[model samples]
Target chain A: MALEMLSPALILLLAAVLIGLLKGHARTAVVLVAPLLTLWAVWQIPDGVQGTVKFLSYYIEPVEGSPLRRLFATVFAIMVFVGGLYAYRVARWYELAAAFAYAAGAVGVCFAGDLITLFLYWELMALFSTIVVWCGGTPAARAAGIRYAIMHLLGGVVLKVGIEGVVVGTGSIQIQPMLATDFSTWMILIGILINAAAPPVSAWLADAYPESSSTGSVFLSAFTTKTAVLALILLFPGEPVLVGVGLFMVMYGIIYALLENDIRRILAYSIVNQVGFMVCAVGIGTQMALNGAAAHAFAHIIYKALLFMSAGVVIYRTGKSKCTELGGLFRTMPLTTVCGIVGALAISSFPLTSGFTTKSMISQAAVDENLVWVYMLLTAASAGVFLHAGIKFPWFVFFQRDSGLRPKDAPWNMGLSMILFAGLCILLGVFPELLYPLLPYPVDYVPYTAGKVLFYLQLLLFSGLAFFVLLPLMKRTETISLDTDWLWRRAAPALIGLIERLLGSLGELVARGRVRVQRFSQRIAVRYLGQPHTADREERGVFARSWPIGTTALWIAGLLSAYVLLYYL
Target chain B: MANQDEPLHWLVRPATIRKLWIGLSIVLAAVVLAQTVVYIKGYFGVDAWFGFGAVYGFVCCMLMVLVAKLLGLVLKRPQDYYDDPDKDTGHGQDAGQKMSGTEERGNGA
Candidate 1:
């Protein structure tokens, strides 16, 4: 009966299945309704209710009361709704189903109170997200999906090992803040970092996200890394190493995004960049920093999804993603262009957008902690965000060289979703209270101020000046930029090939030696054991061949006499 | 849908600088209005300043475009960079359509 009451996770899971059973417009309607139902269920989760169950030897607790968890779950549920609307018409029912299940996993993760529950939901998220990637219905999509799954499963394995160690060592599975001094904690941190797309393996995000279907990318962009961020915040908050790691990721994303030719890849890298900010905030470990990280995750999901949806529409209509192949489409798809620009501005942290409100708090915390260099780097990264995502994406996709393609605007459902998210971005930007109150910590920080606002304007505007003046240098081309991933993707493969060849030659040498040794041993055995002169003499009778009868009688008598003499002696 | 061959007018070309200015001004006005509302709601304070975030955001975007453009000069191959121009393999359905007649030699066999 309680299960029948429909939790947010259950509602979304059912909606996904129901959508798969429907067709065409009916499927679209089902997709739209699914998120709303989940939203209602999220709202119904009563405060301070600790939902738990015992299975096997472990206690699974998914607490449903914390403002932080509620905030994330709420936005996740809302994202599913908006994403559903954006994708309803074009996407297959299976994709929609996977998307909802993925959203449910995210929500389920938010409420997971114990390590076991968290791990379960975390792997589930991986499963459904992989399905979403495969639903792109392209060869590239399939390949990307496989790569995505491998990376996620690797992360999951590390996490499972860490969880087991922690349970064994601590004798408790409560989800609590952990220090990185011990092996188990370090294992868990590594697990979370992998999901966050920290360096070396970070290329997976850019590599796989763009290959997904347009609608699929929208869902892909929001959930995975952010969930990792949440996990990190829950376990390993305040680890100073994360600050450096996060900063590296932020700058790495911007640089690579600048070099990327694909529009979605640019956005994908920005996801890394944005999550970097959150990661840094978590490292800061102050109440303000934690709050900032939580709030940024909330806002980032909405705006990033909006950007992806806008791009999806363009790609859907034009069948081109490269900036060089596309341009000046704003003439026809004005609404999409506007919505995209809005998303772009928000991502760039333009004042009065969701980004400005949510992202600035982290920087402020950095300043408070007197992390002068980190603050400056973050500020520069903020400027770079505008350059890569704010201007580059919109400029190339909607307002560059006229590609002479006259495609209709995105379908009504897609348009409506974009409009809704665009409005939310602005709304939260103007009214930070709507989100600030939902942070895990008490809200004492203000987002809008004269001095801070002026300083940010000066910094960002100069960055814009730099971009326009150097336009010739920022042209789009069809090339993949190399990163740390290149080591594994290219160099590692080459190294493996060389090693294989060397091993093959060694194997040949061993075979030749074995043959030579076998022949030598056989020859020696034949020489020592052969039947020859000795055996023939023994078989032949004494003097039988010549002078047989007469000589034999005399010889016998002489032999008898010799035998008697020998016996007496 | 407008015809592709129509003569270019100032208002429509680049969607017109005038239109660009107008649209940008409208966005600016909207931002101002939103700020005013926040201010009235007592949400604006020492933390909620627009000038810095706006200018910073704009400059950052411009810089990104420039960097991408510079990279493009070196990195951008021709439109058919990945495809073999002379090899009418027809393996790529879209590529086949784009390269119907030209049979130039491919760089990498």
Candidate 2:
């Protein structure tokens, strides 16, 4: 008997539906088993487009395979499994459903063969991820979810316009490498960049992700931006503008993270920083750089999830998200503390960690290309990464002065997820051979040369030194740092209020004009038609008085006689 | 909650941490010294300078911290700056109270 095999996305989506319908343990079983099944399905798909159909005039390739696609899909499936484990016990039933839907969207995007298929999955993510944010169920979460939805919906519209433009301009809808030369491609780039948390509009990431439920945030940390990186790698590689854009994001992330007081917010800003490295690598567009970008994204999702899972544990146990309110957690939550540090070190690209294995290739690419200034700036940004995220996160959240809050370690499942990812971080770092082969291109680079290790160690350690030396200055405050979101969040509303007030005054002026016109007409009616009521005639003023017909005739005759006399003269 | 007299975990004690910091700094300095005996390869001209990574890392970090501090003057606002005044009680509420609220909303975890 022949059987139809569903795409991995459909498998997860179906599981989400089943989970949403059931309660208690059945839902959990579906939640846990669904991702494993999806992973198996992901591995089963062959090397080319398998699921193709004609929709309207276009051929839709929903199941496509390549090393890059498989690489991203593999990590995504792992994320679902791990993220599901972290979230299973704590997350609401609906949140689990939404989260699975979100994951399915991301996996779908990874396997999409054309822009149309990509856009479909892209929007599915935009929608469900917002629901995941809303699952926080706090007033702040509700507001953040609305803002998140608006930003992504706008991005969706832009992307749709771009796709339509491309389709109309050239009669193809296939996903292929593109340049940002024409308006359509530029729109497409901007659309993807928004999801990637690119500048001026990057505020949405920090504003939303931190507000999600702890478990939701764990899922939130993985998918959306990394998928955007995948999209960029697929299209617009070697676009020179991305180099500048990526650098801006790197420094911006560091500065903002340093300024942040909320521990989760710090992590959120660091996401921008890490993704910046990937974006920059894609801009480099060399085979090694592309490999670096893909490898980094793969590595990044694991470690970043590990970090968020740790933070989630803290928030779960102590119910505080701000660094000022955290600290001394290491005393009670030793496992979480260690896991978080591992994640932090990996994020900092520490030697013998996943980051070192993946992130250095981009810098090496910069060197190979001999882009002097870009190389220097990227090197410095690496140190900044170590400074802001590497030391700052662990120190403030785990080891700062005792806040008298002693939270217990994470629950077993959450701890298991952390350990799995932490082990992966170290494993991938120590054995880059495993990850390198999965990369899109051939691997010729050696990550652990003696000289390279020494250089990185020196950079990381001194950055550590600077952190302590300037420790007195890194005090936490009860403040929020404003960003470009303020343009839409505050300024747009303020402008609307200003316009409303201006219109109010205009309405008053119109009312006053109507009153004057009413009075003038009343005067004209009395003067021309006379006051018909004799009883009120005595009360009438000069303008409202009746005029005699003879006086009017005599005035008209005098004006006519003057005109005739002047003409004769 | 003030357990000042309670013996801390040995790894986290103030004295132990201080010693640890000193040990780490010494190790870092030793690595810096090793750079002299074994010169690290550099792709760019500036990277070839002895102790370049250490000096650049430190200076860049210092600049980043200082610049961030300067930005604080303009960028920082009260924690409840964006909150609805009637809804949010700001950061002054005790952690216990806020935590319960978060938990009640099913969002603390």
Candidate 3:
């Protein structure tokens, strides 16, 4: 009889407020319960515009339900719960609060029924995620946090402009699927893609995420980009531009990650690569592809968080993140090692892993669409994923030559969270039936055919061979590779300096010309008056004085009359 | 802190590692060979070719590594390449220079 008045998002935001009010074990309990409560709230809302309100001259739907919405919200809720467990022991109380607030924004975005509400929640995520990044409390974190904030704020402004344009152009504020027929729609797509870590600006993900506190990075890995993937699926599915953009991101991520040395940054780049699959699936826009994007986003959040948690434990124990400095931790940190490998295999789309079940659907969609190039590229990228992340991560960090370091396994809560997600990774892969019905579309596609399994095994294993064979070539260096951020980080400042120097010389030349003119005018005034002007300051010539009011008026009139006369002639 | 001279876990010993690598190589060769027996069909004719997955994966990975190597020539810089000159102190552009105190702190090592 009662219409569900409260959204899960509000529950999370309220929980954040409550968390800020409490401390210690009490705050942990609040963190743990809040997400479960939000999940319950998420399930209670039924399909079709659950809550609406009238504002100004327009009506806004704040909560809308569909299979897609529930799927995204469910994963987000799960992320918060697991992420909370991982962070509850290690994070400062404020970081946990900010993370809850960030998750709340992502949850709100999933339920948003209109463009205005979506924009508001989008910016909410930008604000809180920046706070989470700054929670890293290092110089690099501080700088990276500032850059992260600026990038997201710029993206928010673009999205806001698009939303306003769409409202003005269509006379409606509803957030339904639309084509890129106009500037407004394209703006919205570009805005979403930027957050998706689509190229050129994709540098922010790798730059900022690795700098966050280990626990903070776990939360950061889940929310911002995945929310963007959700937005793309909801708002711009079947937009063709995303296909090309996604492929670029896939290869770019692989190459950059291949060149990386820091442990977290490798995972950071791989996140972009993995999201590329979802973005491409959204571009394919078939029911299957949309399902794949949604399903993959769900799988990605779990596996990626698992990976970050494992790495976080390493950094927590050893105080080192670079592969060069970390090796053979499997000796002492066996549980963390196995968990990290599980995450790595999942990410690589190894057979019988969550990735194998979900990611193949995107490639299947690509083939069904007769996108030969896309299908081939996705297959090749799968191999590269294994080479760069699948083998590279576990090999260097856990099982390579000994670096004489013995760090402890993750503490109880962290290990418990990792084990839970690791179990889900396999569970989802083995029983994908559990996931398929939860997709936005009806269930039809199957993932585990014998041929498909064999093909994937061959692809992944050979990539593994390439890794060990090329191990010497892939040695970690004590150097950083340049990315597109170099344009602003180094080149832009140098360009600005050059411009300043040129302007300085020009100003000097103009000053000399003015002095000469002043002397010329002084000689003319002395000649006309037959007086020595040096004797009195008041006798300074017209050019030396600020221009007289009448003279300036006469010059302006003369120029105007000349232009007018020329026109008449 | 534990001394580096302490004995390591038996599984991680250097001799064990060499054996593990040999075992892994044999297992991988078997996996590549299994592709022939299972006869996995591919979407395209080119993909269906013998050892296609292995060849594709190996060649693509090799290209990826080599291209990354080429890129490193231009892209790689001393770890402190971006740090302020004043802050970097002794670690001035030279590879041989010992890192300054500030550089060590910045690396968080």
Candidate 4:
């Protein structure tokens, strides 16, 4: 009976196919309705694994339902709806179709009941997401997509290996709570961390995301890393390593984003930063931390997507994405400016926004657990977040010196999408109870105490002050900062080039040696064989020498007598 | 959108900007001053000091910016650093498509 119920992820996948083939209004109708239908389907599934298929001596559970799964799936469905609204008119058909398929993979991951199903959906996300990246139609986007693919493929391999190890070691593919204590588990954790945009491998995100078309990045921001956070929540909660890794990602995002100039890249790095909070919370692994992780992931999807949508509208209108190339845009695009600021504020965890309600729980977990170090650093990061995202984003893009460019505000569809998500950001922030029940664990936290609100305001406002005081130092230059991705994007190719040169020289040396050997052998042949008719030399040889005939006759006679005597003996 | 005929948007007027800054400073000062009255349940000893949030927030923001600047000294590069003309391989599926002379889209220098 449950199998008869349509899986929401399948609905989206089917819609992706229809989007690819259909034309005109028919396609738009599917694009708009699919996500809502998926949302309904997500709610329809009952708790626990409801659908199973047997394969290779194991039953794969393809569908499962829980508050956590539903929470992520609901937000994902909402993101698809808004993203479709924003991009349906602008994004290429292939991109839209691919993005939908990619999203379906994400939802699929959310419901995946076992490691096999998870890995399959993971690869699906990887494949279609690459198509989405290439849809940017620029060489950099194309190349970045490849690098992204390589990184994910590597991650997939690690994950698959971990899954196989688990299946063989335990003889089951069921998703279960596990620690990163063993090699297999560590692989799974690392694989998921890669998608979470965890450090060292995190560069692929910023490298590829900002290169995508404006609408594409909005979709890109929502699914991949958040799914990894979900996986970490499922598999590696309470793993202490993530605390350090997450903190590093937190600081890494801020510093890099602070140094960044591209509007989208700044947001891109901040994705790593935002996901860092969730990962850190998951590492704390208390019920509160888990709730914080899930809730933050949910809230983050809206505000981050809203931020990207705002940036997309700006780019769509102005054909510019760099802060250096853009300034004083609020003069022309009031709606876009306001939405950008709201998204920025939400991201900075300003009071009465989604971020403030959700992100504080992570620090609260640290405080409860007596992770004094984590709490301290996270607070510092909170201030830094305000500096880089909250103030810097809006300050440069909207209110800095005028650039003398007047662009129209977002089109009707884009504006509608921004308003939708911006409204959600505030609603969730103002009333977090709407989100709390959806979390995997029971809720026992209040985000808006008086002291808490005042503390955050003081922290955030002073950071704003620091921003202005250091305004000169924070100038947006037309530059790109290197990331670990440089190892493959730049250093790997350069390394290959160096090795090629070395190999070429080695071949050249061997060729010279061969030529010298040939010349030496040719001399030996000429000396012994009287030039062999190929040498093209004068015929003055040892046997061909003058007076050689008389000497040859005497020697022949003497040798004949000696040969006869020796033969007789 | 502001009216195009206006010489300057009212928000950007020098006088408006000065007033806004003054107002912003007052608000900042008041928020910090409110901390002295409001009992903040500081998590640690050092954080319980009056104006701790303001001082720490300002100090941390300054440190982030300065550190970012220092990193930029080594990490920042001309945007075109990665746009190698010789990238003849590793662009999966598009290995040989013409570089398409499309506008660079600010992806590189």
Highest-TM-score candidate: 4
lDDT tens digits by residue: candidate 3, A1-569 = 12564568998999899899998778888999999999998998899987678878878778888889999999999999999999898899889999999999999999998888888899999999999999988766777888899999999988888888999999999888998889999889888988999987999999889989999999999989999999999899899988999999999899989999889999999999999999999999999899999999999999999999999999999877878677878888989999999999999988778998899989999988989999999999999999888889988899776767778889999999999999999999999999999999986787887778878877888888888889889988777789888887789988998999999999999999999999998678775553564545666554464567998999999999999999999
For model 4, the superposed segments whose C-alpha errors exceed 4 Å read A1-6, A527-569, B1-6, B85-109
| Model 2 regions lying over 4 Å from their true place | A1-5, A526-569, B1-5, B12-14, B37-39, B84-109
**TM-score ranking from best candidate downward:** 4, 2, 3, 1
Evaluated on chain A only, model 1 obtains a TM-score of 0.89
Q: Tell me the lDDT of model 2 at A189.
A: 95
Clashing pairs in 2: none
Compared with the true structure, the alpha-carbon lDDT of candidate 2 equals: 0.89
Q: What's the DockQ for every one of the candidates?
A: 0.19, 0.40, 0.39, 0.40
* Model 2 chain A worst lDDT window (10 residues): A1-10
In model 3, the runs with Cα more than 4 Å from the true position are A1-5, A512-569, B1-4, B86-109
User: Compared with the true structure, what per-residue lDDT tens digits does model 2 show for residues A1-569?
Assistant: 11222468998999999998988888889988999998888888777777678889898887888889889989999999999999999998899999999999999998898899999999999999999999987767788899999999999999899999999999898888889999999999999999999998999999999989999999999999999999999988999889998999999999999999888899999999999999999998999899999999999999999999999999999888887777778888999999999999999999999999999999999998999888888889999999999999999888877666878899999999999999999999999999999999999999988889999999999999999999989987767899999898778978999999999999999999999999999888776655668545575555556669998899899999999999999
Question: Which candidate's lDDT is highest?
Answer: 2
Model 1 chain A poorest 10 in a row by lDDT: A537-546
Model 4 interface DockQ: 0.40
State the lDDT of candidate 1 residue by residue for A1-569, as single tens digits: 25522346777877778887877767777787878877777776766645566778876666555777778888898999899878877887788899889888888888777888788888988999999988877655676678789989999999899999999999899988988888888888988888899976898898778878899999989888988888888887899989999998998788788887678888999999999999999999888899999999999999999999999998899777766567778878989999999999999888999999999999888978878777767887998988788888898888666667678998898999999999999999999999887888998888887655655555565565566666666755445676566566557867999999999999999999999999897666545543244454433333222445887799899999999999999
Docking class of 3: acceptable
True contacts kept of each: 0.28, 0.63, 0.59, 0.65
TM for candidate 2 is 0.91
Tell me the tens digit of each residue's lDDT in model 4 across A1-569.
45633457999999999998999999999999999999998999889988677787889788888889999999999999999999999998999999999999999999999999899999999998888888888777877888888888999999998888888888878888899888888889988998999988889899888878898999999999999999999888899999999999999999999999889999999999999999999999999999999999999999999999999998889877778767789978999999999999999999999999999999899999989999999999999999999998988888887766689999999999999999999999999999888888888999998889999998999999999999989877767898887888778878999999999999999999999999998777666566666445566455544555788799999999999999999
Clashing pairs in 3: none
Better of 1 and 4 by TM-score: 4
Prediction RMSDs, each to the true structure: 7.3, 4.7, 7.6, 4.2
